[model samples]
Target: MTELLDQVDWQGKLYSNGWRDASGGVLDSTEPATGAVLGQVGQADAADVAAATARAAEAQPSWAEQTGPARAALIRRAAAILSDNRAEFERWLVREGGAVPGKAAFEVELVLGELWEAAALPTQPWGHLLPTSEPGRESIARRVPLGVVGVISPWNFPQILSVRAIAPALALGNAVVLKPDAQTAISGGALVARLFEAAGLPDGLLHVLPGDAEPGAALAADPSVAMIAFTGSTAVGREVGAVAGRTLKRVSLELGGNNALIVLDDADLEVASSAGAWGAFLHQGQVCMTAGRHIVLESIADEYLERLAKRAANLPVGDPHTEQVALGPLINERQLANVDRIVTETVAAGAEIRAGGNYERLFYQPTVLAGVTTTMPAFREEIFGPVAPVVVVRDEAEAVRVANDTEYGLVAAIQTGSVDRGLDLARGLRTGIVHVNDQTLNNDAYAPFGGTGASGNGSRFGSQSSWDEFTQWQWVTSRKEAHGFPF
Candidate 1:
C-alpha cells in the first residue's frame, strides 16, 4: 500500500461487500505531470458491476428504514473524517488528478462543503400531507429513495463531482455504486469508500468500482440500479442518457460547456481581464464550465486583448507539485494533442495568436487568440485547455448573438459598468448559469447546479435538487373503514 492510502485500510482495491481484489485485474495510476506510477488500482468489469448492484439493492431497504436523524449523524461523521484528512487528500489530488496546489485546496474545500450540505439532507422534510375529499379519510405524499444510484464521474474534478452525488444519495437512504474514471479511481472511488467505511457506514451500502467503459455501461443498463448521476463530456453523456432511457431509469447528466465571458465598452478592462483569465485558465481549463469564448465590444477590443494576452503570457505552467505555477499539464497526451489541433487549426483559419500557442509534453501554455470569429473552431467548440479565444462584437446584441450561437447552453458572463445593463444582457443569453459583472466559473453547494440544451437534459444537482434527483414520490391513502362502492 502507498503512503497516500495509509489513512484508510483499503488500498487499490474494489469495495463491494468489502475491500477485495477485482476480477478484471489492476492498472497503473500514472501522474500526468511526470508519467510516474502513483499506484496500482483494481479495475471492475461487467460481472463486478452486477455483484455490486445486487448487493446495493439488497442493502438499500434497511438503510432507508433507519431514522432520518440517524442517517444525518453518519453523514456528519463522514464530513469530520474528511476534514481530518484534508491535507493528505489534497496531496493525492495533486498527484493523481494533476491539480495545482491551489486547485487541489479549492477542490477539497468544495468537497467539504458538499459533505456538509449532504449531512443536512436526511433531516429535511421528505413528504407532505395532502387534502382528502372523502370523509374520515387521510392522504399523504412521500419522498422515497430510488434504490441503488450509480454514479459515473469523469477524471477532471473527480472528487468534487463524485461526492456531490454520492453523499446526498446515501444520506437520502439510497445505496450507491460509484464507477469513477480509471485515471482517477483511487482519489474518486476508493477514497470515498474509505471515508464512509471509517465513518461506520454499513457494508454493502456503498461500492466503489473503478474501471473503464464496460463497467460504466453495465452500471447504467442494470435493472437493479434505479438512477444514475453522470458528469462528463457531452458525447459520453448522450450515450449514458440513451442507455438509461432504454431502461426508463432516472438519470442526471452534467455535461460539457463552451461558456462565454463578454466584456462591454463601459467595462473595467483590468477587472474583466483578471476574471476572464481565471475563468479560462483555472485547472488548466479542464472544467466543464470553462470560459472558452471571450466576446468583447469592438470599441474596447484592443485594450482588453492586450490585458488578456499579458496575463496569459505571464502565467507559469509546469508540474504543480514542484513549483508555484498558474497552470498544470493537461490530463494526458491525448488531451494535449486535441488542444494543439484546435489552436493550430484556428490560427490557420486566420485567428492570430496573441500570447501562447504551444506545449512541451502535456504542459500547455495559457494561450490567447485574437481575430477569432464564430465560424472558427475555437469559437464554436469546447476547447478543454487553457486557451482563451477573443471575439470582437460590434454591439451588445451582436455579443449576445455570438454567445448564444453554440449548441451548448451551460454558462455565460457579462462584464459592464452598469449592473442593469449586465443583468439585462444576461437575460438574453441562453444558458443555465449566468453571472453579471463577473466571470463564468462559479459553484455553490447550496445552490442548484446544472445546464441546458447540449450541456445536459435539464437535470440539476445540489441543495434541494438532490432530493428530486435521488428519490421518487409515492402517495398513500387510508380510510377509517371500508367504504361501500357502487355495484
Candidate 2:
C-alpha cells in the first residue's frame, strides 16, 4: 500500500527558493469514508493565478510554433508514465476523492486511455481544400489551437476529468492553468504535475494552481487566457460562461444534470432494475450525468423499485480502499447534509421512501423513493448523491414528457423491448447521450460526452468531438488576379 504524505513537496519553484504566498498557505482534505486527514494542498489565490497565467502566456507562443507531432510525442510519453504508476495514481484518487478502489482503478485507466487518444491529435489530419468561384480562385480551411486555456475541473472524477481537459489542451500545443476542485487539490494537482514532468514536457506548458472560485473566476476573466474549460454545477458553470463570454474568451462547459432513466412496460425487469440501481448509486450518485430521476411505466413501477432497492442494499458501504466495498461516503459532510435534506424534504412532500434514507455517520445508504413527481425538488433538482427516485409514468408518451420536463439535458436511459419504441423514446428525450435498454453512465472514448441546456454547452471525451471543442478554424483564399469584373 502506498503511504499518504502529510504535505506535498513542490517539485518546481520560482527563482526564489522559498515558495511564494500569493495563494496563502494550504487547504486540508479529509477522506470521508474513514474520516482521516488525507493531506494538505497548497492553495493559490489571485496573485498566484496571475503568476501562473504569466507563465502560461510566456510558454504559449513557442509551444504553438512547435509542429503538432512534437507535442504528441510528449503526450504519448505522459501516457506511458501514467501506465507505469497506475497503482499509486489509483491510491491517490481513492484517498482524495473517496472513490472506491475498483472504480478508482478504472477511472485512472480511462485517464490513461484519454491521454493516449489526445496524443494522436497533434499529427491527425486537419483542414480541407474548398472550391471557389472563378478560374484562378482557391480556398482552404484549417484548424488552430486556442493559446492558453484556463481549466476548472470538478471533484467527482478528479483524476479522469482533469486529465481529459489537460491532455487535449497540451496535445494541441496550448499552455494550461488548471484549477482542480478544492477537495482534491493537493493529490490531484500534484499528481497531474508529475505526469507532465515525467513526460518531459516544457517547464511552463502546464501549471496547477489549486484554489477556490476566486482564482478560477479570475482565470476565466483574465485577458491572457484564450479559452476556459469548466466542469461543475450548472449554476457555477453559468457564471464562468458569463465571465468568459464577457472577455470574448472561448469556453467549454460540462455542468449540472437531473438526468432520467425511462423503463418501458415491455422492458426486462431484472436487467433494467440492476442497471438503474447502479446508474443512480455509483460514485455515490455524485456524477453530473447520473440517472437520478427515474421514469418508470406505471404497470411495473412497484416491481422495479423493489428490485432496485435490493440491489442497492447489497452494495457494501465501508472504506473506499476495500475490495468488498462497492460504494463509499459522500465527498464531505456538506454533500451528505445536502443529500439528506433533499430526500427528507421529498418524503415530507408525500414521496415514498423505498429503502435507505438514514445516514449513519457520513454514509447515506443508497436511497430509493417511489410516488415521486416532477414537481418535487428531489425529482427536479440535481440531487447529486445515492438517491434514486422512481416516478411512475402511465405510458411511453408520459415517460417522454416527464423525462424532458427538466432544465437539464445531460444524459438519459430507456429500457424497452421494441427497438422502434426505444428509438422513439430516445428521440423524444432532451438529453445528449441516450441509452436504449441499458444504463447511460458508461464512458466511451470513441464517442462524444457532454450535455445540453443547463446540463452543459459542449461535448468532451477522447473523441473527435473533443478535438473540435478546443479548436477554432480559419479560412484562406488566394487569387492570381482580382476576380470581380467591374464596369
Candidate 3:
C-alpha cells in the first residue's frame, strides 16, 4: 500500500497563507481503485474560503505591479519545479484521483505544457492601438488584471483543469485562490500550491482551499474575488454562474458536454474506429471534451461499432496502481453508481450493449451501446464514464443535424476523406473546438480552447484567449499638447 501511494503529502489540511486545519472539520480521501484510506483532508467552510480569498486579495496588487518579464520568469520557474517533481505528481494522480498511469502521466504533462504556455503570455500583446480621430490624441486599449480570481475545479483531470485557468490568471497578474474538489484535494490543490511556493512565489499569492461546495460558493460570492474560473458539470456551473452574476464578478466556466465524433460515409472505418475508441475511453470518459456520441453514417455503422467494441474490450482494465490499465476505476462509488444507472437505462431503452458493462466496486468496465436514440440518456447527457453510445445517421447532413441536436457545444469531431468536405463540415459545427480528421479529445496548450452555449460561457483558454479571460480592458489617451475644452 505504501509503495502504491508513496510520495504523496496526504497530511490533509487546508493550505491557505500556510497549512491550517479546516474549521468545518475533515473529510477522508479514499482511493477509488482499492477503497483504501488515503488520508483525512481538511474541509473548509465559508469562513475558511473567505480567509483564503482575503489573503489573495491582499497580495494581488503587489504581484500585479511586478514587471511583466519578472512574472514570466516566476511562471517558468514554477513549470521547472513541476517537471522536477513529475514522479510525485504522477503518484498523486493515481492515488488521489484514481487515474491510470497513462492518463495520469498525460494529465501531468498537459498541465506542465499549459504552465509553459502561460510563461510566454507575460510577453504577449494584451492590447492594441487604434487610429484616433481627434488631433494630437492617441487611443490605446490595454488589458489589466482583475486583481483576484477564484478557481473551482472538479475531480477529473483536476490539476490539468485547475492550472489551465490558474497559470493564465497568474500570468495576467491576478492572484488566485483555488478550491479543488474534495476528491482531488492533494493532487489538484495542494500540489499546485507546493510548486509555486517552491518556485519562490510570494506567500498569499495563491491559496488552495480543499473542501466541498460550501467553500466553493463562498469563494464565488466573495466580494474580494474579482473573477471565478469554474470547471464542472453544467448543473453546478449554472449555480456558480448565477452567484457570480449576482455579484457582477467575471466568470469563466468549462462545463459538461455530449460531444460527438461524426464518421461520414467517406471516412476510413479503421482509422475512425480507433479514434472513437481512444476518445471515448480515455480517462474513463470523464473528460468534458471526450466524444461520447459516435454519429456514424449508416453505410459504415456496423463496421465502426464492431471495431470500437473490440478495441474497448481489449483495453487493459485492472488496478491502476499495479497494472498497465488503460481504463481505471471511476472517481468513487457515486460515479460508479451514476455510470451503472445510465448504461442500464440505455440498455433497457432498446440500446444493445455490445461490450463490457459489469462493475466491481468503483471499477466499471468500459461499455459500448448501439442503436442509441437521441432521447436516450446515454446519447443526450454527459455520461462522464467509459461508455460509448452509437447513433446511426442517414447521411452527412443528418450526421451534422444529429450532432448539433444537443444543448452542449463543447467539442465535435468529423472523420472524412475529402479535405474540402471535412473543412466545410468543421465550419458548420456549433461547438467551440472542431477536429477535422482527429478525435474530439484534443487539448493542445497552444490552441484557443473553450466551448459554446451550455458547455461553457463564451470565455476561452490558451494563447491570447487565456489572457483575455483573466483581464479587464482599460482605454488610455495621452496628449503632448494641452487642449482647451469649452464647457
Candidate 4:
C-alpha cells in the first residue's frame, strides 16, 4: 500500500485547463490508520475559484450545443477509463478513504455503472411536446442544461458521490466546479479529474478544488454558478441550501438519515441477524443510509440481539490492507472521536453495551447496543459509525410508529416471513425507500436514489431523473403561420 501511494504523485492540485498548481498554501494529506503524512495537497483560494468558474462559463455553451449522442460518446469513454483503472482506484480508496476491499469494490462498481448510466443520459428525452391552443402553433417543453453546476461532494464514497453528480451534469452539457471534502481530497476528487482527462474530456469542463469548508462556502455562494448539487451532513446541507436560496440558484441536496431496519416477529433469526449485522456495521456504519436504529419485534428481539452481538463481536477491525480485517478505520481521528462520543453518551443514557464499542486509534469496534431507547443519543442522532442500537417494540404497529418517529425519511426495511405483510408494512413506513425482507443498505445504479424531508430535496438519482437536477424545463412555442391583429 505504501509503495502504491509513493508510486502515484498524490500531491493534490487544482485541475482547470488541464492539471495545474494551486496558488494557495498546501495541506498535508495523512493516512488515518498510521497518521503518516501521505503528501501535500495544494489548496485553492478565491482567485483560483474565480478563474475556474470563468473558464467553465466560457466552455459550457459550446459543450451544450453539441448533439446529445456526441456528448454521450464522451461519457462512454470516461466510463471505460474508470473501468480500466479499477485496481488502482480500489487501492487509493483503501489508503485515503479507509474503505475495506468489499467497500472499495462496490464503490468502483457503482462509479462505473453510474458513468455508463450517464453515458446514456444525453440520448434520452429531455422533455415533451405540449398541446397547443391555436392552429399552426407548436408548443414544446424541453429541458436545457444549467450553465455551470457547483458540485460539493462528501468524502464518503468519494468516487460514487462525486461522479453521481458530475457524470450526469457533464452528459447534460453543464460544466462542473467540484469541491471535494478535505479528508479524501486527493484520493477521491483528484482521481475523478484524472479519469475525465484520460478519457479526452475538454479542459475547464470539470474543475476540482481541494480544500476545507472555506472553498466549499465560496462555491455555494458564487454568483456565476447556475446550480448546486451537494451530498453530505444535514447541517452543512442547510447552510449550502441557504446560500443557494438567497440567489435562487438551482440546488439539489442529499443529506443525512437515521434509517430503521426492523425485524418482524416471524423473521428468520439466522438470516435477519446476518443481514442486520451487515447493514449496521459494513463500512463501519459510515453510510448515511446505514440502519442506525434496529427496531425488532419483542418476540424475536432477544434472539436477534444475541445473534447480532456475536457477529458484531467477531467482525474484524484493523488495517484494510490486511486480509484478516473485515472493517477499516474511520476516515480520520475527528470522525473516530465523534463516533466514540455518541456511543459513550448513549451508553450513559441507559443503553446496554451488549457487544462491541471499543476503539483504538481510528479503528472502532463493530458495536451492538441493546436496551436503547428513542431518547438516547445513539438512537436520536446519526451515529455515522459501526454502532447499532437495537430497539425492541411490542408489535408491528409500534414498530411502524417508532420507525416513523424521526426527522429523517431516508429509508426503512422490514424482514419478515410473510411477503404480503411485509409489503403492507412497507407502505405504511414513511420513507423515500422501504425494503421487504432485506436490509437498508441496498443501492442500485439504475434505480431512483434519494429521500424525503432532511434526507434530500428533490434530487433523485438513477434512471432518467438524474438529469432533472441539472437542467431546466422551458416551455417554448413557435407560430408557423404569420397572423396580423386588426384593430
Error of 2 at 416 (Å): 1.6
Instruction: Specify the highest-TM-score model's number.
Output: 1
Measured by TM-score, how close is model 1 to the native structure?
0.98
- lDDT against the true structure, each candidate: 0.92, 0.82, 0.87, 0.87
Clashes of 3: 0
Clashing pairs in 1: none
TM-score winner between candidates 1 and 3: 1
Clashes of each: 0, 1, 0, 0
Clashes of 2: 1
After superposition on all C-alphas, the RMSD of every candidate to the true structure, in Å, is 1.4, 2.9, 2.4, 2.1
Task: Please provide, for model 3 over 1-487, each residue's C-alpha lDDT reduced to its tens digit, 9 standing for 90 to 100.
Answer: 1221233443657777766788888888788888888777778899898888888889999999998899999999989878877888898899878888888889989999999999999887878897899989989999999999999999999899989988989988999989999998878877777778777788888888888889998988999999999999999999999998888999999899999999988989899999999889988888998888999999889999999999988987767888878888888777778889999998999999999888777778888999999999899878899999999999878888899998999999889998789889887779998989899998888888889988999788886788678888999998998878897
lDDT of 4 at 337: 88
Best by lDDT: 1
Segments in model 1 whose C-alpha atoms lie over 4 Å from true places: 1-4, 7-9
| Clashing residue pairs for model 4 | none
Per-residue lDDT of candidate 1, residues 1-487 (tens digit): 2333575556557888888889899868889999999887789999999999999999999999999999989988988888888887888789888899999889989999998999899998889999989889889999999999999999999899999999999999999999999998877877878888889999999999999999999999999999999999999999999999899999899999999999999999999999999999999999999999999999999999999999999999999889888898899988998999999999999999999998999999999999999999999889999999999999999999999999999999989999999999988988999999888988899988889999998888877899999999999999878978899
lDDT of 4: 0.87
Residue 133 of model 3: what lDDT?
90
State, as a TM-score between 0 and 1, how close model 4 is to the true structure.
0.96
Error of 2 at 314 (Å): 2.0
Which segments of model 2 are wrong by more than 4 Å? 1-8, 11-22, 134-138, 459-462, 478-487
